[model samples]
Each structure stands twice: as structure tokens, then as C-alpha cells.
Target chain A: QQQVKQSPQSLIVQKGGISIINCAYENTAFDYFPWYQQFPGKGPALLIAIRPDVSEKKEGRFTISFNKSAKQFSLHIMDSQPGDSATYFCAASSRNTDKLIFGTGTRLQVFP
Target chain B: DAGVTQSPTHLIKTRGQHVTLRCSPISGHKSVSWYQQVLGQGPQFIFQYYEKEERGRGNFPDRFSARQFPNYSSELNVNALLLGDSALYLCASSPSFGEELFFGEGSRLTVL
Candidate 1:
């Protein structure tokens, strides 16, 4: 069973626009939610993360808005750039378990 | 410090063959995890090791196995390779369980 489900298999956005990708998980035990960015022929890299305690976390142009009760989280990129074009994955995991459950992934293309 | 490093950036194998992929964690990082990513999909956790001990494993068959060395490096071995096994195998390293992880470039295995 896939614990986390991400929507919008592919997305296209203008360079300076806002790009949003959403994900929902089933396991309530999940406390850590992180987003990873991956370029072609490369491994996924940590982009941003948010814990259940906080409603949102922002790092520069990347932001993670989480809703604990809804069991959902969304990643928003402000002023999206061409460099941001890549595959993004949303993952969830519990405190003790080091294993991460990942979503289906979303491919974003930012047009210049 | 240098980031996580993986070996043999790419490999090609035939059915029924066996292959081994290697990974070296970042300096001072004691935890390593393996993930499998197929085309157009997210990464699925395969196994996690910390301090030379297996901390977590995914729902993979016995044909898939991994071990960590004393230096925090790891090797993933797959026996009797199949066409379905062709995918990108990624290795991630972290300071500890449930901490921020750094990923390597990954080894792309193409099973013919």
C-alpha cells in the first residue's frame, strides 16, 4: 500500500509564477514530511521538510504547508525558475522508523 | 566534506545475472539507505542500515540483499536479475536515523 499519494503527474509554470504540488498520506503516525527534488540522471536531493507540530515551514523560495488533521501537505515554489524544473517527491516517515514512504512524484517544468 | 558517493554510475546486465552496487556515505554519517526508482515513478525504500546494523527493510524478496561495512559504506546485491529490475538504485546517507539525508548521483542498472 502506498502511504503517500501525490497528484498532478506533470506541471508547467511560467518563470516567476507560483508552482504548487500536493500530497496526502494515510498513516497518522507519520510526523516528518519532506520534499525532494531530482534532476535527470541524478539522485533526489532534500528540498524542504516540515514536522507535524508546525502548520508551515518556509526556506527561501520553497515552502511546505502541512495540515495535520487533514493528513495532507503541499509544496509551493515562489517565483519559480527554470532551474527548479525537475521531478519532485513527497515523503513521510515516523519518528523511530528510518524508512520513508514516497509518493508517485510530480514532474515540473518552468518555462522561461 | 564530500557528499555521498556511489560507484559505476551505470551498468547493464542480462537476465539471470547478478549485480552489485556500491555506495559510500558522507564523512561522519553513520546511516545509509537504499532506494529503487523506476521510470516515471517515485523512489521506493529498500533498506536502511545504521552503525553496521540493519534498521529497516522494505517488502523485497530474498533475491535482494544489502550489507553495510564498518566504514559506513554499503553494497546492494541483486541475484538473478530480471527485466523488471531495471531501474535507478539510489543511496542516501544521514548522520542518524530520521535525520536530514544526502543522496548520491545513483547507479542506473539496465537489465536486458
Candidate 2:
């Protein structure tokens, strides 16, 4: 079973615009929500993360807005740049488990 | 200082063969996890080990097995390679279980 689901499979945005990706999970036991970014031929890098106690977390231009009640979270990138163009994945994990359940991923393309 | 490192960046094996992938976690990290990323899909958790002991495992067949050393490094072994096993195998390390993970570039495995 796929615990986490993410959408739109692909996205296109202009430089300096805002880019957004969303994900939802079915397991309410999940407490840690994190987003990762991956470039071609590279490993996924930790972007930002949020906990259920907090509704939002921000790091630089990347922000994670989480809604615990809805079991949903979204990633927002302000001033999206070409450098930010890559595959974004949202993941969820429970405190009792060491594995992470990842979303299908969103491919973002930033155009100049 | 060094991030997670994976060895044998790429490997090719024929059906009925076996393979092993290695990973070295970041300094001071005690937890290591393995994930499999198929083409066009997000990564799926395979196994997690903490302090040289298995902590969690995903819904994978018995063909997949992993072990961690006292030094916190890990090795993933897959037996009887199948074409369906062709994917990028990623290794991640965290300070402890359920903590943020730092991933390595990954080892690409191709089974013929």
C-alpha cells in the first residue's frame, strides 16, 4: 500500500515565480514530514521538514506547510530558480519506525 | 564532515546471480537505511539498521537482506537477481532512528 501520495507529476514555472508541490498520507501515526530534492544522477537531499506540532517550517526559500488534521503537507519554493528544477519528494515516518514512506515525486522545471 | 557514501556506483548482473552494495554513513551517525528507486518512481524503503542491529524492514521479498557493521557501515545483499530488480539502490544515514536522513548518490543495479 502506498502510504503517501503526491501530485502533479510534473510542473513548469518561470524564474522568480513560486513553485508548489503537495502530498497527503493516510497513516495518522506519521509525525515526521520531510521533503527532499533530487537532481539527475544525484542523491536526494534533505530540503525541509515539519512536525505535527508545528503548522509550518521554513528554510531559506523553501517552506513546508503541514496540516495534521488533514494528514497533508505542501512544499512551497519562493523565487523558484532554475537551480531548483528537480524532482521533489515528500516523505512520512512514524516515531516508532526507522523507514520513511516516500511520495511518487514531483518533477519541477524552472524556465528563465 | 563527509556525507553518506555508497560503493560500486553501478553494477550489472545476470539472472540467478547475486550482488552486494555497500554504504558508509556520516560520522557519528548510528542508523542506516536502504531504499530502492525504480525508474520514474519514488524510492521505496528496504531495510533499516541501527547500532549494528536491524530496526525495521519494508515489504520486500526474502531475496533482499542487509546487515550493519559495528562501525555503522552497512551492506545490502540481493540474491537471484531479476530484471525487476533493476533500479537505483540508495543508502541513507541518520543520527538515530526516526531522525533526518542524509543520503548517498546511490548504486545503480542492472539485472539482465
Candidate 3:
């Protein structure tokens, strides 16, 4: 029940295109969902996050659309750039837990 | 301000051996969490420490252990290392429970 499943093991898009990665969680206790970006050999960096109380949250060109009833959420990178190319992971946690449950990563490649 | 920092960027161990990885959290942050990321996969939680006290632990075996210092730094030790233990060990810090996590570059452990 702690699993957060992510899909599109890999994605390819052109510069200026939109890149999206999806994730679903099985635990209903999860209230916070966050997305992370990881470059090769580096630890994951917090990109954007949202709470279940809200339907969406945006930070710069990155946006997260969350569906509380569906137990799913997604990250959308607008105007995707090569610099944004990296492995993206979606994670979830609740105020009751100190640990964040992460999803299988999605490798995104934005081509010029 | 310095972010979370990890030591011995890489190490190699053999079966039946033991290994230790270290981490120093961001100044003023009292919560630290450790995770293991195998190649091409998301990080799996290992342990979490808050205020020098263990607050959470993942589904790892008894061979895995960790401790936190008064300074909020931490160490993860794994005994009887197996080849499956070869992976990147990541350390993340947060100001409090259920907060955003900032990570270090991570230590790469190779068990042969």
C-alpha cells in the first residue's frame, strides 16, 4: 500500500514541447505529493510539490496536477528544454509519516 | 548555506564485508533520512532520524543500521554486504517531519 507507481519508463520530446510524467499512489494517507529531478550521479532535487487540498500547483514552468479521488498525480514541464532532461520521480507522504514514498523514475530526454 | 552533504562519494565492498556511509544535514535542520537507489530505479527509504532520535525505518534487513549525532549528522552501516546492496546511498535533510527534503550527491556503493 506504500507504493507510488510511475510510468513512461522513458520519454522523448523536442525543445519547446510539453513533457508529462504520471504517477499513482495506493496509500490513501498520503497528503503531500512532490516531484523530483535527478541528473546522472546526483541525488534527486525537489522540483515542485502539491497537497491534496489543492487540485494543482505551479512553480515557474513546472506544474503538478493532482487528483485526490483518483489517487493519482502528474508533473508537466512546459516549454521543455534540454536542461530539463533528467530522471523524474514522484513521491508522496503524509504528516503522520516522516518518510517519503517514491515512485519508479521516468527518464525524460528533451531534444534540441 | 551548505546543503546536505555526504562523504566518501564512492566505495567498494565484497560479500560478507561491512560498509559505512556518512551524511551531514543542513545547519539548523534536525531531520535526516537515508535512501538507497539502485541504477535506473527510484530511491527506497532506509531510515530517518530527528533530533538525534530514530523516527522511522524502512523495510531493510537487520544487517542495516544507523545512528544520528547531536549535531544532526548521521551514519548508515550495513554488515554482511551482498551484491544486491550495490547502489547509491542518498541522505536527505528537512527542517521537520513531512517537510521538503534536500539531498546530497549521494555515495555510490559497489558490492562485489
What TM-score does each model's chain B reach against the true chain B? Answer: 0.98, 0.98, 0.98
User: Candidate 3: misplaced stretches above 4 Å?
Assistant: none
Error of 1 at B76 (Å): 0.5
Q: Write the per-residue lDDT of candidate 1 for residues A1-112, one digit (tens) a residue.
A: 4479998899999999999999999888888899999999999999999999899999999999999888899999999999999999999998966688989999999999
Off by over 4 Å in 2: none
Please write out the lDDT profile of model 2 over residues B1-112, one tens digit for every residue. 7899999999999999999999999999999999999998999999999989999899999999999999999999999989999999999999999889999999999998
- Model 1 ranges with Cα > 4 A deviation: none
True contacts kept of each: 0.83, 0.89, 0.80
The local distance difference test score of each candidate is: 0.93, 0.94, 0.93
For the predicted complex of model 3, DockQ is 0.81
Query: What does DockQ give for each predicted structure?
Result: 0.83, 0.87, 0.81
Please give, for residues B1-112, the per-residue lDDT of candidate 1 as tens digits.
7899998899999999999999999999999999999988888899999999999999888999999999999999999999999999999999999998788999999999
Clashing residue pairs for model 2: none
Model 2 Cα lDDT, one tens digit per residue, A1-112 = 4489999899999999999999999988888999999999889999998989999998999999998888889999999999999999999998966689999999999999
Measured by DockQ, the strongest candidate is 2
Q: Order the candidate numbers by DockQ, best to worst.
A: 2, 1, 3
